[model samples]
Target: MSRAQPPIAVLVALSAVGPLALNMFVPSMPGLAATFAADYGTVQLTLSLYLIGLAVSQLAYGPLSDRFGRRPLMLAGIGLFLVGTLIALLAQSIGMLIVGRLVQAIGGCAGLVLSRAAVRDLFDRERSASVIATITMVMVVAPMVAPLIGGYLDQWFGWRANFWLVGAFAVVVLGFAVPLLHETNHYRQPLPGLSGMIGSYAILLRSPVYRAHIALIGFASGAFFAFLGAAPFVVIDLMGHPPSDYGRWFALGAAGYMAGNFASSRLAVRVGLCRLIQAGMGFMAAGAALMLTLALAGQMTLLALFGPMAMIAIGNGLVLPSGNAGALSVDRRRAGAASGLSGFMQMGLGAGISTLAGHLVVDSALPLAAIMAVSVAISLLAFHALRRANRQARELAARTRPALPKAA
Candidate 1:
């Protein structure tokens, strides 16, 4: 409960753990299935269940942090992540590995939810957007290199090495966090148990502007998820490219996203969140149009697939931070809940869109491009709807708010 806030580097480190752990083990999935003598569907549970855990856990963490504190929940989350890593490292069956991953996700997402909440607690909306963009831009490197490191580890020492490395990382973060991390939620509210927590969420959900922000965040990120799910098959299967090519070209998408985040970090305070969001949706629309146009033209090259995806990534970078900052600003007292709800929607929608893309992208990349296009369209609509609602709300407030007395 110290007055000092955690440093940006510490916040970045805390946030990176979740995404790093999520991607690092991906290269080991096939090998893991072989080792466990399990079917592909069963082995895939490790990932799908992890996503479920991340989404569900955020719902609980937000309200709990509002009631308890951020620092303690953060420490507990990292501790659980380490414990889960240990469990995965020693797993004897696919079932055990699946369970470990779920646990890891539950713990890791605490950082994802609380880090934003902490930023919201400490700063106003625009500044919070700037800080969040900076944090995201820095931490983007974690997922960018995760699969590369995981590939090497899985090739050299087997999949267990991935868990060992992640566990060590968790330990280091926990060590630094124990003394450095302080409670950022200065205004802790009372929750009369489960019903009260639900009521807090209900209050947030009742706000049209809040729901609009969530839609903007969810659908915007869902475009990226759809690409992640289907782009691999379109690149490797339909285009007849090597698996390595997919990884190589994927870097372009990551770089574009990083660039966009860096732009947001620098421009959020100056350009304003709403304008940035509109510009972001513009980029996404252009990207999706390019993707679909190329697919329909019978051009299935790697560039045709990843090039537009890179543009969409850039849009995602712009939208996510601004949308999150807006959502968190809705009700400062329930900032934690707002952050958590937004994260949940983002994850849940991404999961659904990605899964659907996976099933539909069998023959061509057209389906993938279409899905991205639709997702971006929805996000743009949400952004406009939110803007209109804000104007109306302002008008109402201006009419109702009392005028100041003329006496000086």
Candidate 2:
């Protein structure tokens, strides 16, 4: 086996790229709009398009990594990301900027998908979950500080500086990847044709264990994306916080998520993956329910909003690592397909929820809270279904196993 190169550090570096790529440009959104002379709605398309690119491209990256190997794909993706950053930096129009963002996303999705696959490559469920949690604990800082850093950059050197910074970051990651990262997909064999790829995915989809875990993670992720899409508008536009204050609020929620990840890392080994996920879903549900109630009562102040929001963030952090690790644990031989399918479902659901929440955003916090409640409730249901499936699997295995000899 290739030496596992400190999974926690690898994950931290990989996870950092995703949020940094997205959030570093968020503070510059208004400025970008003004520069392009576009409406706010049009400018928001940059974010939407990035998510679209990320979701769609992840499917290709996962299987390709499986077919070819992880290190080469990762290195090439980083190169592509750097190129995209350069394009964004030099873009003179909104359309060009959007194109660059899309390209960046295509490359960024590699880091996300492969990181999970790599974890699954090296570890089992509980250990993988712990590794993911530790990574999340460190990586959560990206979102917390990205906007703050972006804001300063926007104020100082204009929006193009953000892209330049991203380019530099990409180079740094590439440097690390060259020496530290190694191919971990020992089971992966070269596919001879399209039919082989299709068969791989089909086999993964047919597995009940994989489906349950993927669904749980997908819905749980949707809840967080719903919050992310709606929170800025609710906080800044409805709640009267200045745009500049958004970084602080974003940091608060990220801090809560970081705390949750830390807790999950510590607890997953002892509590078991299923129990930890169950507890997390319960917390998420409770938090969402409380937020919904407060919004309905018209008592959703900043403090009221962030308090329950923190709970949801924490719960999601706890659940995601376990859910992903469980899904990937089902088939070591097809971990890449499992990782691809799970990434597709997770990002697809996230995109849908973000879009729905964005459209449902009204003049109040009610819509956002309601969306979060629904997402969390769905995730809770998914977790229960997974539990039921696990029980059935255990029973089936018991029935199929040979009976022990009467005398030893």
Candidate 3:
């Protein structure tokens, strides 16, 4: 690690790009629809396509980063992201804008996967969790402010200006990344062939611990993804709030998330990541259950919905960093692949949940609350499985310790 560019800095820089990609243009969706003379659903395809591109490309980026080194792959991906941003800025049609989003997502996947890999590269399980939590605290600011800024830009300038702003941001990040980001995968040797790469992934996928952690992250993230996908419909559409009001509501939820991330950073070492994960899942389950109850009772106000939603967001902030760190900790030498696979599962599951929830949008809040509750329940199941696996491993290790040498 370079003294000038620490792992934490790299994680921050990389993770920051994700929120920029996802949230910076969100407030412009309505403007974009009018600009292209398209329906809202057609315009929303920009989000859907970006997510789909991000999900599918992680499988490719992980293996490539594993084969070729983290720094090079990350730089290349950012370069692509920059190009995509420029394309979107110059786009004159809805189809062109969608294409740009897909391209941007393909590039953005590098940041999402490689940043986690870099953390696993530099730190052990506990330390990695702390680092991720800290970085997440900083990264959450993008969502908090991006939409606010985007709304102002759309109001003052035009929807195309949002893409121009993103392009400018990407240019700045690319400049910073070129010199600051160092290669972290010191133990990664390039595999000889496709068979070798496939064999390596097969070996990693065999680990019960890794799968358990990945599942925990996937479902936990699904809760937030469902909220992200459905919040516009439930809040701005059904609840009759202005679209600009999204920034305020999202910022409150994001504040809770950032607070949880900060708390996890401080407590993961003392309480243990496993314990934190279990506790976080419990909080999420309880929050989702509350939201579901309110929705079912026909008394779900916006505050009622957003209050538990913030709690669920906070729980996710706690669970995600720990689960991701745990998954990557299972195989340090294969950190890139592990990070990639875990990112694949998390984003893949999030995309599915978000898409399903988007389609289930109705006049009532039931569908959204139902999806969130199910996601939390699934995450709790994963946490339980991880706990049992950890116990079994401890028992097996004790059994194999030669009966403590009979010294006692």
lDDT of 2 by residue, 1-408 (tens): 545553457656865776688888876775565689986667776777787778887778777888898777777877888878877888988989988898898888788788878877787878888987887788888887887787678777888888888788878887777878877877776763678777888887787777888888988878778776667667766777655566666677778788888989999999989888887887788889999999999995877787888888888888988888888888787777778778888887887887788678878888888888888888877887898888988999999999988995
lDDT of each: 0.86, 0.80, 0.80
**Residues 1-408, candidate 3, lDDT per residue (tens digit)?**
553334466668776776687887776775566688997778777777787788778877777777787888888888888888888888889999899988999988898788878777777889989988998888888877887777777777877777787777778878888878887776666763668767767887787787788888999989888887777767766787766676666777788788889989999989999878877887788889999999999865768878898888889888988888888888777777778778878778877887787778778889999999998998888888888887887888898887546665
- Models 1 onward score TM values of 0.93, 0.93, 0.93
Colliding pairs, model 3:
none
Instruction: Give the Å error, residue 393, model 1.
Output: 1.3
lDDT of 3 at 12: 82
Backbone clash tally for model 3?
A: 0
* Alpha-carbon shift of residue 135 in model 2 (angstroms): 1.5
Per-residue CA lDDT of model 1 for 1-408, tens digit only, reads 548878888888999898899877766665565699986556656766777788889999999999898988988999999888888888998888888999999999999889999999898989999999999999999877776677678778888998999998889988888888878888888853788878888999999999999999999998987886667557655776644456567778888889889999999999999988988888899999999999899888888988998998898889889999999999999998888888888888877887777677778888998999999999989999899978988999999999999997
Worst 10 residues of 3 by lDDT: 1-10
Q: Pick out the ten consecutive residues of candidate 2 with the lowest summed lDDT.
A: 1-10
